[model samples]
Target: MKLDRKNLLWEGSRMFLPEHRRALLQQRKNATKLAVPKIDEQQLETMTYILQEAIEYEQPVLATYVTTYEVTCFCGFVDKVNQMEKYIQLSNGSQTEKIPFYLLVDVTWP
Candidate 1:
């Protein structure tokens, strides 16, 4: 069977827009449904202090990497935490990468 280029292009483009719009709507809906835990100011301050201490002490922090619709993965030995962006900087041998805080599962003290 042979396909017409113009017809194929038109059909493909028609299919793409609805999928993209659905994905965008679903993402927005999911974001609206998220229920994040809220910590009081004092507790938040303490957690920040602890994180700073961990960074200064060179302790290994454990974190979990979460995806939109998957079982979370674990990341260990996080060397730096960026609270502002809710991400952590981790070291694997000589390499390092920044990952989201929601992905972190655990932390270990030095």
Candidate 2:
């Protein structure tokens, strides 16, 4: 049995009232427009150093990073860094998060 994606989407949306649909769309738009702060070169270098040290020593670090969806404060061991990919991987024992370098707001060493 083939399910038409367009039809399925339409049918699923039919379950939502007009007000619910409007609110859901508004939330999506706002989530996509999160503010990202700008950092000067010195601050960037400091954060980079903290990350490098943590990665080198396998130590946990506290860092504040943001994204289009939300900002997160994480204390975790640095697992990997990919400068070309512009991202870093952090593992906090419970979960590992992939953070974009541009979204990093701050880093404080332990």
Task: List the candidates' TM-scores in order.
Answer: 0.40, 0.70
Among all candidates shown, the one with the greatest lDDT: 2
What would the per-residue lDDT of candidate 1 be over residues 1-110, giving only the tens digit for each residue? 88788777777556557788999999887875533344466755654565677667766554444455443433345576676898877785776768665543333343
**Best model number under TM-score:** 2
Regions more than 4 Å wrong, model 2:
1-17, 24-32
Per-residue lDDT of model 2, residues 8-90, tens digit only: 77775567688988999998888687688999999999988888788777789987988667777988888888889998888
Query: What C-alpha lDDT, on a 0 to 100 scale, does residue 61 get in candidate 1?
Result: 52
